[model samples]
Target: MNMSPKSFLFLFLFLFSLAFTYGQEGLPRLRISENQRFMITEDCEPFFWMADTAWELFHRCDREEAAFYLKKRAEQGFNVVQAVALAEIDGLQSPNPYGETPLIGLDPRQPNPAYFSHVDKVVEMAAAEGIYIALLPTWGDKVFTHSWGKGPEVFTEENARSFGKWIGNRYKDQSNIIWVIGGDRNPREGTSDVAIWRALAAGIVEGTGGQDKALMTFHPQPAGPGGSSNWFHNDEWLDFNMHQTGHCANQPTYQKISYDYNLQPVKPTLDGEPLYEDHPNCFNAKELGYSLPEDIRRIMYWNVFAGAFGQTYGCHDVWQMYTTDREGINGPLRPWKVALDLPMANQMKHLKNLMLSRPFLTRIPAPEMIPANQEDNTDFVIATRDSEGSYAMVYFPTGQSKAVNCKPLNSRLLKVTWYDPRTGNQIDAGIISKAPSNTFVPPSSGGKGHDWVLILDAV
Candidate 1:
């Protein structure tokens, strides 16, 4: 078989094209609806996105370990994991803690193919487990530098745009990748960080192949509200809103801010970053250490009931601990594997499934339906009803037993049931009178310290 030179060249080109396309298999290309809904792909329902912080993914361990952690998170019902491309700890720039692979090139300013290869593997593994990665390019590297890697002068507007473009192209077809742009640092108070942010976002949108436009949002510093107000809130590129309720547990303040954002005009919103593991409880001014199961559950339910689309969870070890050895770091370092196994994961799964099972849970608003009395600050309650008016959910956060009045709810035949969120137990159920209003006395003390959910169904 004597083949001509031209024919051989043509054959080589054809094979190369085939290989290029085939290599991209399993890459996620997400699509959003015209109305801004997260297009459900491959039967992926819009269940509440229960998430965890994996800030150590690239800095602490290798690809294999990253996969192991991500898989465990999926098994435990965490659908999303938040991570930073350039971490806050030192020694991550080159020749990582593991000693075999380098984090970046000798010139930290230039892009390293080897480093991105490791990241690609991690993103691919997460997609395999039906888990999405909230990819953050850098931490608050612009404003502060810690033991983690230092930020290149790339923090400037010109460099940020270039960085965003590079990042977008690298992960272009990855469907499971969610682009989160900001770290804890905000643009200089009155400066044009806004212009820099917008430019970066523009580059990301451009680089991400039209195949799947990644959902975009910003991660503001703790206590700062996420959205256009701070940085790129109203930016046309942003698809959703995210807020950090401070590192300390400021439940009341978080509730107030969340309530306000829920009423915002733009797209779906969430508390992307809240208190971390073992952080102090600002309300009580006590060092609670890591977030306990009850604390996670309370925060999650509180956010959802207050009209947040999703809640992001964090752990002290996972957020601040970079190395597997957990040495040289000032914070706690519980193995993320153990953190995933915590009872809080199971609780989140059960509660989220129950809420989604009812349609009314999605349609109601936080302000119109839920009532919080200023005189009795402890009298905060959040309520939601199904679209068909068949069912309603009410969450009471105050530990003390209090009366919840529902005057707007009018149904001839109403049935009230109390359920324990932790155990999924039906504590009690009974018929109620058709009065002008109804008062619900939640079980004060129970499996968890939080008040119980009162489920009302029309008979």
Candidate 2:
């Protein structure tokens, strides 16, 4: 049967509209909580943004490999995957597994549709797995190329906006998309970096319709004091704040989390990058050695107890999808598939469950409850509580018994328990008297692996 050209055009347009509609309506869009401290779903449900860094997902993995990674992470209770469109490991020069580069002639404004089609497929696959894609439009190298990244330094203030708008439009309808700007590079004051990122953000807002269209944040390179907030915290487009915190052990990262939490203009914050499961601690394998699972577990507890809404877990190997055939970032021990089951990845759910087990929305940082000097201690004791004083948790890094100021808590009778962050087990420690201050000994003590969280549930 012969078909009319007009009929073909009409059919194509109709199918495209259907796809666009599904993209928008398929997942619940995330929004900032009313308290401006956490993420909530479109239906007003608490959303714990447990994410895994898969910076090389689109660059290295084919469709099958990408899906496999998503399935595994979703099962591990990660609701978000932090990935990149233009990856960091020489992404512009090297083609993807499909032999397609993201841009035509390394020009940000002239994105190659063929290359982006793979990115589209990866994001769609993530959505299908009930996962949000925390997408970086381009890695930091593409922007600053400051110290390490290979530079052809392709982005400018003008093209940054154009690229941002185009990429934003392509995924405007995909509900699971969370735009993360500035990649891993921090914008300097004197340079055009800030202007370019702002332009890019403006383009995204334009493409997606408005500032309220999606959740947005920046990923910074462990720049202390404020991290992303050092620059963009006051910006309208930034929905939350994130910090890398680098890959060192005994970092006292809770200090960073608490700093952001108490900023003049409050915005939600979390550790975008913490010490990875097996990264060379301080990037010195010869001396400090690879990070243990305990290193990551402590950092996670430290950040959350200090008032981070959620945590992002990473394994040095898995983020790059390391395989025997490829060169490693920092001496990866296993392939990405094996790295998926690394202790911290599976154990991350325990933190998610612990947070959700409590009264989530009402929680606030209780730094005053912890001894001021302990704030900088490697055996750091940190605390958080229901803003209403309904419940509280204090983490003992190395399980050191410390006197906690109990006067601030309104509860007269408190039921205390020792929560093992490593095992997700809560052991009863009997009722406690609420007074000006109290000393509670942790069930386990004396080293890094002996971490415990003292939980107080008030009647």
Candidate 3:
């Protein structure tokens, strides 16, 4: 068969497409659900976004260390690994174990192929383990250097676009890639900084050849109530909203997720950077105590019940790849390798299992189903229910007895149980007749560490 020149070219392109897609066939491609409030697989299966923060995975660790770290997270039921390409903390100056920096002379336009090849291997490894990489092209320092972040500010609008396109084209074919912009810095409105990030977002889209292959979002600084919301909520390029509730003790992050949940144009939201398991409260170990396992559990349950699509778990030691040889930032208690086996890391999988065990894609925040309590302290309770009101969950931060308004469930009898966030075990609390208001005391009460989740289902 003598093929024409045009036909020959078309055949070559077709074969290339097949090869590209075949390489990614085993990976799960993710997208925003039709309702725009949660994530689902390409086949519309519910995907609970359980993530762990390891921002320095590529910048700090070698292939062997990276593999170990990833394996532990995979075993812990973490489906997403959030990392940065051009990392924070003098990443531009320091080289990886391979002795390569991401940029030549700290130029955003000049990404070193050798350095990015390491990142590629890491991403591929994560995908092989059924983990998606929520990749930040560059940390916030590259564009908006807020609060003494180590940065030379290498990205202008033009270079930002070129860098983003380069990264987008590089990872476009990967099924497990999620493009997250704005690493801990929000571009001030009416400034050139905003244009820089917007250009980067556009460049990434263009680099993907206009295919929305990966979901996109931003990680703003933990400064105010608004997170990425105040900057890019309405941006066409943004697919979801991410907030950094920060490492403060008892930060009312549920309020933040609740606010984003009720936005006019509904978009999925999550606490991308919650309080880490062992980090100091408010970044001051001397003044404030370290965050206990219960502190981490409280934030995780509170955010999810208050309408967050998922939660990201962080550790002060893990995020920076801390070691005794290196001076610890924010008082890292242990090395990254040791921090990997912390109880909180083991316990995080329970949240994903619990959510998936129940109905997916049909849950909504239902605070009205639980009556308000008069707790003088900041500790409080939050509630959520299936859209049909067949199932509901309430979280008590301090284990105080609270009255619930079961009238919203509309069921004759409700089967209640106590869910232990620490162990992911459930204890039956007996059945109750649905009423206008019912008060239930937890197994224990009045301690910062005693947190409980009340699970109710129609009987």
Candidate 4:
């Protein structure tokens, strides 16, 4: 078929639009929506926070390596990259690839500009790819030394505030920077350590001059597959709640998300660190076996449909930037560079796409819409619906059939469709007469381990 001149022009413009959508450089500053349940751009465009965990991005990867990782994640539909400023593994003692430590004489107030310049480059690199950097100022060990991490406890209250202010000022003008204060550490109640983290957050506010230009949240240590809401949910500076589902398979992620979702002061929440793809179960590589891409698929859908504003995906090797030169922390099987193409990293875009395809602002978790038992087992189905009750999504992690309470959907005739989380495709399940209870059996996928998403739209 020959194209007319008008058709050719339209094709050209369409291609350009696609390029602009993906290739646009700078990001609009993100803010919580008016309802306080989700995030939006400054212009109120719905922002689904699909992030990749790269905790060691600045501390381990060089400039070129950082660029490569950022570009790939952008193509994979990730909008955020979580990284550390003062890394976890010997971050204070070890120099970066450029041979510079973050502080002078292990002093938080005396920041080395040379070392920070490298972090500046990584931030800029991420921004150029239209990605936000969830910047952790320092790993948890610096203040609250637990059993495992490298720690000398360098932070005093005065220096914590100073360092927070200094780092906050350094990237104040950057549109893509989000401050992540706690690096997987929960400060015990009535401890000076709590004061340290609060001071750092206060200094960040002071440094930013309380402009609210940068979004901030805390990354709590998994209280054994627990949430940040357990510690800092009520804290004023915490913009959103983040939960670390940890490396355990079959975590009851919905419990954590639901607990935060219904809190007195409503805030957006997400699984910041779910089971990293390919991570050994419970950090045990030998007996328990590594989690696959489907494990991530299960966590992503369960948490998001249960009322999370966003979700972060991780790979064991990529988080640590593990390579032959360094020890394989937690038994990383591949180098960080090689692990970048893991299937789940690419699959995360599908979840973002599915969420964006529906109503953005008015969506809510509607567990009452599904009749599945909310037990600790892997077969638990999760459900969500539009506030208007026009549409609903149910996630089946192990491909099991479940009875749904269609009356909660408020539709006489319900059009059901099956959405494949793995492939990002929708399969029609035909309209059915709506009753109080509707038994919907998904297509058989042998028995277990296959997952499917059930979408119901009121006709």
Candidate 5:
């Protein structure tokens, strides 16, 4: 690797600073709040999980490329990055950029240190940038070998636990690590898949010192209702629930979030994978076409409004780390480097800021604030408010006019403002008295790309 003297100095200082920061105390460790509805920083501040999907980061990117990706994402305000270790694209046999496969002789017990050293450096680099590695030890195909994945199915129940233990122990002290199991596959009944996954969870808990030492969850393929909760809600190790709304648009993902929210033995829920920016809509490019920025923004707001803790954003090209030299999946519009700055990629921070702008920790779904059957249409509105009735936020998909029931907010006048999701700008919508119902309309409304968020704060 050729470098100027200044570049070498920067790397030295970056490493030195991180070594000091983590040596004293790592990046603020996370924990499920006492309410069990959200995550909190070590100091107990609400954690808004703005994450990006980089499934192939470790598998595809070299050190310099990985650093570039992490810097861009950190600048975009993403605190978590979902990536894999035993990657999905023929990872076990295929060597990483360093010419080292993850396992030696396809043996789970014999992990290749050279490859894992690269993984360690990437994790450390992410830690330096204050980003949590939502690390998956292995993709699901390594366990089940599903229809699409190129897996040789190397893990048995015993080896799965052993591998999980080894990996968990390796990163046990990294404060920015969050163990995410199950890479895009759900367990089938009557098979050992469920037991194998459970054993992996137990192994992580044991290796990481104990259950409290780790914040963990499962990432499943797009499933019907409760996603991860459908399988692991009752499991003691699952700290939260994750759903993949999949590569489709106009999905009422909030309904799925609401289902998980209302489930007994409450656990925080989030859409780990929504429609990627440039993905073939529903995997059918000819008929449905590619996903637009508007399509992904709707899913993000809907998940947050309907009681999700927080959610992740993905780009089809970025997840696969596609370049001109590589084969694009489902017609990638651009290379991963160019896809990094795609319009919606920067727009995601707006939602995160809007949620944190007010008292968001106590917030809950405010469906009563919107009219009945509004969700029946694609251009529907969704609302959420502080559990204390202090503030409310409503997302207007097409910026439509609606009679919002402000009475549910509180018996007081409220200060309202229009939040532009596209630009992160706010326009005052004037104050209104709390009445039986109130009509609020956005400045513009016609079709796709005309979305608005109404912010209501009690004055």
Candidate 6:
């Protein structure tokens, strides 16, 4: 029988839709190099750091909620998510809030296969969005115990290895997974805990088919750098260094921590967990309230400029919240849910693009490059340059007006532009004088202020 014209058109449209959907499903694999660098097949070098802090995974929530959060993260230009396997609040044995799906019993020493299956789905979904997963096995689970999960007793070398093997085998082939070992805290006895972590690292290496190992790091307690300084800092198993800045909102102190990490000899370092939304500032409790967008930007740019390869952004309530329902388990999702849409996310994207645009064979921060005028203030400045002198980027953030001077490559002929980081807009041509000094005036606005990016190119 001959098909009518209308019928033929409908059939063609349906086939076309399927092809489009299939094309969208394709995603890149994320893997780590021997040097501990995060390697992606796509040219994501000068890697733009787009990350979010969804620290809770394997919580009371279902796989569906995890997928929703991961998908939402990708939509907002977040290519990386920092999450824990045995969620701090919920563990493998935690009750399933959804009565429809009953919890299965599994040895707590080994990862619950059911929970990891959920993790696999989340990782797969993130991969489809070009997002990578920074998977942490347990959140201080090895050292501490609370309502979340059994710990201390679970912090044995054998158990760590078994847990690592289970996880590594599950996603061995998936390149988008980054293995993060430590949580927000460290082990009690330094040597034994290090041994346990090493065993786990070995398990991951073996399970991931070895050689092509996953990028690995330890997440230390607040105000600490992954317990690496004494324990795993230079260990062959560690790929990079990660630090938590605690919940302090003081911009100056937070930025300094980044500067110090930049000086480490290892591959690269980053602030894995910084101050979260609604967290009280340690320095001043009543003076500075929580969830200020400017405070977030200050910490982010400071970390990036100070030689950190990436930064993680998070909200307090969201980081701690887990749910079985669509409406989110925490408080009404008004201000907290909307926090992701804030200016900080867009600003980081713009900076990532700028960094990737330049050819950076080597980047060295020039502390001496900062001018005397800029040195006396609380504002933090970090400068880095490519080897050939073709490109350079400087980030300067000060609560008050400050003049900055830097050594310029061909100062007279360099093309300089000041970037308003808030909107990612560039100001018209500004020149660096032959004397190699430029004056930058911080916005007159008090405490909550703006940062500036100075891009210089040899004309």
lDDT of each: 0.64, 0.89, 0.87, 0.87, 0.91, 0.62
Tell me the tens digit of each residue's lDDT in model 3 across 1-459.
999999999999999999888756667689899999999998889999999999999999999999999988998899999999999978898899999999987888899999999999999989877899999998988776777778868899999999989999999888899999989886776779888988899889988877466479999878566678887889878899999988887677788898899886889999999999789998888989899888788888888998888889998899999999998887899999999889889999888888877787889998786666444344778888888878888888888888888876758999999988878899998999988888888888778777888888988
lDDT of 5 by residue, 368-457 (tens): 887667544568799999988889999999978888888767648899899999999989878888877788889799877899999888
**Lowest summed lDDT window (length 10), candidate 5:** 371-380
TM-score of each: 0.81, 0.92, 0.92, 0.92, 0.95, 0.82
- The clash number for model 6 is 2
Candidate 1, 1-459: lDDT as tens digits: 999999999999999999766655663444343334223444444546678887767667677778788877787778888987766664344344445332244233355676677777788878777788888877766434433446543466766677778889888777788888777665666766667777678778877854247578887665444433455655667777677776554355445445445444546667777766554454232445445566556666767666666678776666654346656344554565565555665666666666666652234543444443544233456676654567677876554454444444556767888878777777656888645446667777543456578887777
**Between prediction 2 and prediction 3, which has the larger lDDT?**
2
Question: What is the C-alpha local distance difference test score of candidate 1?
Answer: 0.64
Arrange candidates, best lDDT first.
5, 2, 3, 4, 1, 6
| Model 4, residue pairs in steric clash | none
**Which ranges in model 3 have alpha carbons more than 4 Å from their true place?**
1-24, 373-378
The 10-residue segment of model 4 with minimum total lDDT is 223-232
lDDT of 2 by residue, 1-459 (tens): 777999999999999999888764567999999989999999999988899999999999999999899999999899999999989988998999989998899899899999889998888889877899999998988988987867559889899999989988999999999999977898878899999998889889888888899579999998979789999889999999999999998788888898999986778999999999889989999999999988888889889988889999998999988999999987898999998998999899989998999889999888789765744656878888888888888988887889888766677999898888878888998888897788989997888888888888886
Q: Model 2 — which ten-residue stretch has the worst lDDT?
A: 370-379
Q: For candidate 3, which ten residues in a row score worst on lDDT?
A: 369-378
After aligning candidate 5 to the native by TM-score, how far in Å is the CA of 291 from where it should be?
0.3
lDDT of each residue in 1-459, candidate 4, tens digit only:
999999999999999998877654567889999999999999989999999999989988899999999999999999999999999989998999999999999999899999999999889888888899999999999997789889768987899999999998888888898889889888887788778888999999888778476588989877733477776778888889888878888778888888888896889999898899879999887888998777678888989998999899999999998988888887888888888888888789989999998897999998787765567777878888899988889888887778889886767999989998877988998989988888878765543458898999988
